[model samples]
Target: MKGFLEDANYSIGLLDEGATLADIIDNCIYEHTHTGKRAFYVGDLGKLVKKNTQWQNVMAPIKPFYPVKCNSTPGVLEILGTLGIGFACSNKSEMVLVQDLGISPENIIYTSPCKQASQIKYAAKTGINIMTCDSDIELKKIARSHPNAKLLLHIATEDITADEEMNMKFGTTLKNCRHLMECAKEFGIQIVGVKFHISSTCKDLQTYIHAISDARCVFDMAEEFGFKMNILDIGGGFTGSELQLEEVNHVIRPLLDVYFPKESGVNVIAEPGCYYVSSAFTLAVNIIAKKTECDKLLPSGVEQARDDEPVFTYYINDGVYGSFASKLSEKLNTTPEVHKKYKEDEPLFTSSLWGPSCDELDQIVENCLLPELSVGDWLIFANMGSGTLGEQSTFNDYQRPLIYYMMSFSDWDEMQDAGIASDTLMKNFFFVPSCIQLGSEDRFSTAA
Candidate 1:
């Protein structure tokens, strides 16, 4: 609590531990008011870097091309950009975002199969010629739009009942993959390689091996078609936490090296969006209110609410509609559990945390088991903004939350000039001119 976070409302430093959560909240609101932005502590993009480094290590022998769509937060993107990872973008907009970040065109692969002619033309014009296609129709489209573009034939991975399963869409069948390659040959597009996605948060490991084997078979098929594949873009599905990248790498690297030898010049690539940002930051909130319920004996002897027990409710300031969208799991709910400060004979109890928004369904945790939390107590939303919020766009009258970085002021200022800011700056700074386009004539100066 010793750093100054700035925004339009005001710049404030961290206070002593004696300070109340209310005070911190008030200061944040104040900073937002003055700076017209809430200054978050972004002294350094620590959380993201740590996670990305872990991912880089774990995906060793297999290069990572962070999916820009996962969390295009400037902080996350800048950190990944500095790390020199390639990008896996699905649309022209993301391609534009990568360009604006000064990411080289060669480091980007346009992986969306059903893109517009303009997107394909833009990708080729910008020298970002590596693209993906799943059908002969798409191959023809790329051929017609960008004859010299290099393309990866996407092979759909079968869905596994694991946590990470990206099979909702994309990729072509073996026959279609071959057809696409042959069609590419007819159109003069470079058939560079093949790729697959194992869906994010997948639980099984061997599925990846199987998917790779399937890809290798497709490579053989492509080779039969006179196409020499140089890459195997295994879409990322490493499901371990950020801290376990090294462990994951140790387990998967040998498998990959043995299966897809580098002597063959067939490099490996991964599209990891969740791995680089998840677990980097926590969403800490205070319990603003609590409620209890009483049960009455129904019809016969069955007690509904029991004796004096009550259903406690802890309301915080964030919710599923905002940054906690991923927790919804296709439904709006959170599994909030409570832990006690000290070991007690009472054991652990449970409760629910609700968001501050007025929506009736704005609950964070449904019924979490905890050590009886009280009003004014704080709880941490582990892996909220870094992982979930990044994918959320405004929808259904819900807005994303303001980021709150916890860091020092001098560092915040330095980053601000460098086009980076703390969460507080995101909360406050609205006047700083952002570079909207890279390589655009308007942003560059004319030289003699």
Candidate 2:
């Protein structure tokens, strides 16, 4: 029951030796662009699969529950489902999306702390008993609607200094954790675990140590109340950097072993959103227009301009309102790389990139050096899989980008060999008539 990309197509090919991601993007754009929309490589999902495998290896006994709100692309979700990872949904629609993918209700956690009465009722109706709450009012709502629910009290971490402070909006403080747990107890609710997010893009691993310590305190309290705390939901704030994750693991692994030991029967899980999908997607943008600003001088000795500095302003098809919404929402700065290979002597210049919108706030990059590019040339940004497409808007009549899923022919073979790919997935692997289709006819034998 997985969803498929309706208008999209795929091809099998051996990527050229030493071909960079830029090369792959150039080929896709050259072959696929009709009206100049963005392209997404579904093959990138393989990278995520690898990451999940690595996460499992590094932190065994700690399962990963991908946050659907990060990148709800059906293809991404389908791939994760095939990999046997669970999902962390925020709303009823997201829950329905995961359920439609044939994932069981047990594999999904409604992670949103503040829920509407209707959403709570929907979760109850769908038999999604696992949910999170941070406040007393939410506890009351859950008690009235789904007292049978397994609750995870989200504890707020202190002095969070990350790029995005999730605690500012959600999570209860350590002092308030007891009251919420007490309220849940009063309502005869099942408090099964504790949860906390240090913050999104957290740089300080110390916050994780503190938060886990706080969760341990809550576990002790729950035990005192005769409740068997069996789940420790460490909410996600991971950026997909191996070194960073390793550093985090260095701290978390020991903590889990000590606080929630294997013999303790605690099921540890995480709601990772960006970590799984961010590095899997690349965004290719077409430069639609360009303008050069030269210093202008005025009359008399006032000297309006002293030096003639050249600055190029390039307008791209995708902007803040489109696929680059992360620029505004997450304060994410994407470094743009030109698609063409430049010679050693090729000149570079300081330039700014803008989106296709008329709004002044549609700027993407402000004062960066890039190889001189033309209106038709393509510029790509990597690690754009998360926090971008899901929040895109169609403002100013600019259509959203068309995502192109890609996979190396070898990886496709592996997926088929592993029996992880569905019949629908295999059937949808075809070349667009107008685009370049690689491999021999036998390679596309199932395309018909």
Candidate 3:
């Protein structure tokens, strides 16, 4: 946490006791209106601490290696590093980022299946020996660049999802696993384990049963070749849902006991990207412009609507090209709560939110009922920390919004209880006073 304090790239605001997240957001919104409104993010660092505790309770024994590509916010990395979680880096820059935080080389795994040769050399020089590879080209690259590299054979478990799209992008088939093992043997690369990913879109928990079963098969095959297979990576598909996590755990725990029992000396890990960060941050975007039409048909693709009703199109400062970039692949959970209070009796109308880029593709929220808001009013989108910052593609001189990191005193205490008592961590504990005046007219938004 202290590393990012002086780094100028991030700003963390420590909240006083009872100083709610909404208070900080209220203060920020008040200040922004005085100057001019721009999009900004409020990250509740306390949520990360809570999520870590939840992970420990539910997903114990299976260590978590956070994929840095998901949301590489410095504050997130700092907090997760402090929690002693291993990192799954995909490139040299990510590896360097974690190592700079004093992470041991063994605590990091280079996860780029198709890594660049120079980056592979960089990992070799830096002692990042654990890496994932799926094909002979990758094995050859690792062998030539870093012969001592330990490899996790990235196997594409039979894609049972409706699209089977994720497997096509990475992972070698089970049949190809033998050939990959043979190639590693020829190239003198160390094939140490197996790794597979289940897309978040995959609903079937049976997929885990099949994938874990496939991994066991590979481990058995490794015995014939004399390669000691130890690690089993049940890769990312976790969607910040407690029931889903518990459900998945219930299915996998028994299978793990049956296949790779405790005495097997196998280390189990999962790459959880969104599970840790998504619900921890909120984005605040201002309504930059507005247009209203009466008795007109609503937008075509928007989900909810009433025909021949008033429709409003709101242009926000940030859009799909910026903070909401995740909208490209996954749907945006962008039904924002209005930032300004209004009467409960105020009529709601079908509204569409768009970006200032003026591109028709820049729509943020397709269709939702919103209180008719003025251009200067703000909107708050919760659960935005899931790779939104890392996925942004800014256009039209749009600067990346400043992230305001926040943590409650109780959470800070809990973090200490969790055994992160590094002296440097307290250096940047800039606590705010509990009694903050949130202006005369507006304080914070709520159900109206």
Highest TM-score: which candidate?
A: 3
lDDT per residue as tens, model 2, 1-448? 1112332233323332343344446556654454344433423555766787678777666789999988887777877887788999999988998898789999999988679889989999999999998888989999999979999998887645655554346788777878877887789998999998755556668888898999999999887677888999888877877777788889898888899889999999987777888888887778888987653333456543546556789998878887788677566545887876788787678899888886789888988998778878878787888877564565888666656555555555667776777876566454323232434232212222
Q: Return the clash pairs for model 2, or none.
A: 42-405, 42-406, 43-406
TM-scores of all predicted structures: 0.71, 0.87, 0.91
Q: What lDDT is reached at residue 426 by model 2? A: 62
Whole-model lDDT for model 2 versus the true structure? 0.74
lDDT of each: 0.61, 0.74, 0.83
User: What is model 1's C-alpha RMSD?
Assistant: 9.7
Candidate 2: stretches off by over 4 Å: 1-23, 32-43, 162-167, 295-307, 413-419, 422-424, 430-448
For residue 318, give model 3's deviation from the true position in Å. Answer: 0.6
Candidate 2: 10-residue stretch with minimal lDDT = 439-448
Cα displacement (Å) at residue 229, model 2: 1.8
| Backbone clash total, candidate 1 | 36
lDDT of 1 by residue, 1-448 (tens): 2222112133223223343333334444444334333112222244455555466455666778988766666655655676667898988878887787788988999988689999899988898988888888788888888888888888877665644343356777876776676677777778888888876445556667777788878878777778777988978765436544555565557767776787888998888776666554444455656665433323556566434555666666556666666655543222432322456576455577776665677776676666666765556444443345444534454434454433233334544565544453345322211222333442211111
